[model samples]
Target: MSRQRPRVLARAPGQPQALPASLHPVLRRVYAARGLAPEQLALDAARLQAPTALKQIDTASALLADAIVAQTPIVISGDYDADGATGVAVAVCGLRALGAGAVHYVVPDRFRMGYGLSPALAELAARSGAQLLITVDAGISSLEGVAHAQRLGLKVIVTDHHLPGSVLPSAEAIVNPNQPGCGFASKHLAGVGVMFYLLLATRAQLRAQNWFATRSEPNLAELLDLVAIGTVADVVRLDHNNRILVAQGLARIRAGRARPGVQALLQVAGRSAERLSATDLGFVLGPRINAAGRLEDIRSGIDCLLAADLQSALPMAQELERYNRERRAIETDMRETAELMIEDSDAAGICLFDESWHEGVVGLVASRIKERLHRPTFAFARAQEAGVLKGSGRSIAGLHLRDALAAIDAQAPGLILRYGGHAMAAGLSLAEARYEQFAQSFAALCAQWLDEDALQLQVHTDGELRGEEFSLDTARALEQGGPWGQGFPEPLFEGRFEVQSLRVLKELHVKYRLRSADGQSIEAMHFNGIEQLRERGSLHATYRLAINRWQGSESLELQLLDVLD
Candidate 1:
């Protein structure tokens, strides 16, 4: 696959004067460009939107309170990913603290059962003798599963963050912000965020009934550590509500008040809890937890979070680390194969399949291809069932992936067996025999939907850093200014530099000693960028300011994002 040179543009300037005079000039400009007001920069937990704003939250909370009062057996059905794993941990811990007697969880096997709540999963939950079923991160699209659970004499409540289908499931209570008629202001909550909100509402209900008068009330704030991990791992937009949640969680972790599981995972990842950032959560810990669901069972990841002590959790974290290493190897091989397959065609959208590809790793492969080509790409692998192909898709801007899949499904009924996801990412399954048809249909849809401007890759930067601003203090200030992700992006700057020296590391990464046009020498690293550098002379680059800590000292470094002539 040929690399497309992206168009570089500066972000539109913002009303920096509107911000506090104490803020750094760069940060003021950065915040202003994102349209964040001075008050919006405050990420106190108290600033979070009230749970009462969520439609049906009261009903869901009352139902949960009743189950706790009756000492009913409950099962939490969670999706198989980082968000789902953390959400399960939050639910189990929060409910047990709230005086629930019996709460068990069920996660689908990606290889066997596939994603989400299904009739098969419901049967398994019913067999556990659960009278009440609560779904975390899933069940919005599980109409059949909800009906099946109800038929088995179980009351169902769904707490998902995914977009709902045309018809809502007939669960006892649905608490998705994106559902029709829901007035929740933050529609971008992750699965874990929704579960955390539900817990808050349930705690309030229990308090209203004086259930906590005789017993100790649980500090729901203690669960924010897991909430932060899941929210960032799931890659949800960091709206004001989410930023508050993550900020609180980070404070707890920094204060050494996080759960044993989180501490143990951080230990394994070699990240310091005191200086952890949202980037660490997304890139360092998220992948390790998600590796379990992708390759083996998500229960391992959940068990780590549920562990009572670091000694008990370390082994599980190590297991997750092993799974992550395996996942990386599988992803690399699959990506190479996909690149070879798409070397010939220049379709607006891309679809690739290999019988040898692991079903669990297709999503990562799709994400890699989509990032490289800036196209909506799907990668498929043969499912456990013969003649079935399971696929995962990642989309560029201007394409709603789930909506695109829905359009294809509506235009040709029976083409897709199952599908659900968000705007940028989604999963689906179809017959292996229909691969060609689905490919052509997907390509046609993307071609029809995307225009030249949409297809062209673009990188927006926050202008350039002044010579005096290129310091460790500046990097630290920028780092402190964000719990950034998705909609709230981290600050990126563009500049021209003369390459003083360059060296290739392991034949993949390029390490450069560069002299900025302002005559300051700086260190920069371009990971997996050996191919992008043809002329080592003067070059334009977009990068993020970073603090590189080694041994005991920290220095300013630039993490290159893109390079241009």
Candidate 2:
């Protein structure tokens, strides 16, 4: 959907280092170009910064240990996203394994109770007889929710990664690297990662108190598989510390040590856990879990993760598969309609709304339009409350969506009733009657802030590749190099290629044979972009090296990212 032409600039290799003689030359160059030092390449768990360095993590761990010792009832409140669901599952599973008593969880339905540990969710936890409330992936901005929980006689601990507001919430223990005065080096920990650290700290505390004298200590590392899945799903930048976590988790999954739910979801998606990669985790399994949260109750997804075996998790996985199918259909329809709106607009930013759109899928729709136009885009659906619309926004690289909204709110008070999110994504609520005003304001703000060059879509590539570097072994080696995602990107290579053959698939995908100057032939695909390519002479193409499997065999292929004729 992107309109970017291949810029094809050879990335500048950062501070130089001598790569290992045995390492693939192309990989060594690629890693160096991406600013990786020789030492950062090895993703050892020991390289991870200590959890105790995170502000208030020690206090939060002690609180949990005390709750376990007193046998107090604890409720894990979670968000409805993949990060939240996996964090809740990790917390409950790890805490129970650590001998915590009466552990339970509650995930707010996106449409009903909204996001975070709201007062309504707190009352539900209270009714369930919870003595302590622990929020995962949320509650950093829940000033009112934390106060309500405190009033309801619940000891609270907040663990989150979202950017915090000027005023912090009043909680017994708050552990977020992004929070002011905290020195946790890696600020990119996913919600599940935060919960995982908390468990590690709790285990250490219990060990110091000799609480594990009669019982064997729970192996917290076993939870890394879930951590890996959630971290990739949340789309956080994978820094070195996160790379270690994902690498360890992926190792467990590849070694057939994945949880039954993970196996089941992978089965439904037709992906093999034995050969799992971070890409598979992000695309195949993450969406299935996220589908439950998008279209139905997130509890179903958590149930699948919490199931004991593949046989038991199968039903939920199948149901999630069904939800994914339904979600795809809805997304397809919403994307089509949103694209129509984009084609008709000339605004620097895009904001669209239709009463018929499902509130649950606006974020996905927003993402699609943003990719299509490379503009900061927001898509809205009618809220359950009359005269209100809920919107989800996605931003391009140059623009910060949340900061823009915050500025607009400050300039025009009451324009945004509620809003919060990161730089790339955000959400807001406002009066239905004020849609046009808000759109105009947002578009003007974007125009005022963004330069013409910033709005231009550009794709950076790692320059040309040699014939020997295009082999299946090279692809596999590149895949094994590191767990790549948002910030630490997978390599994208660009070169001139002869269009040996071309055909359209499903009227949407372009399937082609590309011949290198050295006569190396490779199959390539450009999904959802058949209309973008015009048959011509040798063309410049940007693509990622990838492995394709069919009929129990694997082959090297190029995943086309963009093309220039």
Candidate 3:
């Protein structure tokens, strides 16, 4: 497919009147551009929004506390993703610490049971001989599953972050920040964050009842490491509250206080705990855990998280590493096929299906296609059921993917068998025979919803860094200034540079030694940009300042996002 050059636009600076004067000037400018206030910079755990603000949290906590007191066997129905796996670990560990007995979890096999809390999954959870079942990362839209579990004589607590359908599930308690009537300040909490908050509230409930008098009170803060991994892995918006969660977790991991599994995963990835960052959680650890769910089984991933020591977790981490490598190979093949499929298509919303594609890797393919074409995209693989295709979708800005699916379902009843997700991403299933109809309907919706400007890709930058600011210190400041992701973006600066020298690596990445207007030479890398460079001597570049460590030395490096004429 032909790639469109994104427009490089400078962000409008915000008033720094309320910001601290002691803040670094460039950092201040970046923060000001994001409209961040002084108080927002404090990412301490104390700054987290109270769980009481989440609708039905108290009720959910009460049910959990009662289950603990009654010694009720609790089964956690978790989705098969990084977020879901981490949430399951957090839920299991926290409950065990809080004195809950017989805690078990069931993760649906993606190839067999598909996504979310299906009736089959509910049946499996019930067989665990549990009287209470709580869903992590999913179940917000599982109306039939919720009813099935209840009918099987199990009380269900649905704790999810996805937007709900028109009719809410009749669970015993539902704890979602996005649920109707919820007044939580941050609606962007990942599924793991929601589960973490539920544990916090359940602890509080136990404390009020003096349930800890005979037992030690578990420090819920210890679970922040898992929370951080899941939140970043899920790609939720890093609002102030989420930033606090991520910052606190990163602090714990850096202090060498993270769980054995987390440390082991980092060890296998060759990352130092002392230098751990939110980006590592997303790019390094998250992908390994997710690989298990995508290719094999997520139970191994959860087991690693729940391992009591590194000795027991290292083997699992290595296994996950192998899964990740396999997943990458499959995803590369699928993405190449998808690119070829869309090379001649002009659909505003692109949908591509291949019977040979791996179901778990379709989401990754869709995400790549969406980035390449700057359009809403969906990739599908044949499901285990004949004539059924499981698809995953990634959306561009100004498009709510789940709502668009809802609109399509409303316009044509029974077209989408199931669907649920946030604005940017979602998953669903439909008959293979109806694929063309669905694709046409989705493209028409995208055409109607997105304007020409919205369809155009735009790279928003924080303008340029001054000559004196292009130093390792400035890069470190930018690095520490954020657990940045999603809504809260990391800083990118745009400027023109003279190419002192250029070399292509692996026949794809372009490495450059560029001289700024001030005659200062800097090293930069543009991954997958060999074609875009085209022997250019000078170019406008949008890049991020980074500290690149090599051998035993550290130097300033520019991570180029775009090169323009």
If ranked by lDDT, best first, what sequence of candidates would result?
A: 3, 1, 2
* Regions of candidate 3 where Cα sits further than 4 Å from its true position: 534-536
How do all models score by TM-score? 0.98, 0.97, 0.98
lDDT of 1 by residue, 1-565 (tens): 5877899889889899999989988889999999998889999988999999898999999999999988999899998899999999999999999999799999888888877888999999999888999999999989999999999999999999988888889998999999999998999899999999999999999999999999999999999999999999988889998999999998999999999998999999888999998888889888999999999899999999999999999999999999999999999989899989888778999999999999999999999999889999999999999999999999998999999999999999999998888789999999999999999999999999999999999988899997799988889889999988888999999999999999899999998999998899999999988987744688789999998889888988999988887
lDDT (tens digit, per residue) of candidate 2 on 343-441: 657678889998889998999999987877778999999888889899999999888899999999999999899899989999999999999999999
RMSD of each: 1.1, 1.5, 1.2
Cα lDDT tens digits for candidate 3, 191-221: 9999999999999999999999999999999
- In candidate 3, which residue pairs clash? none
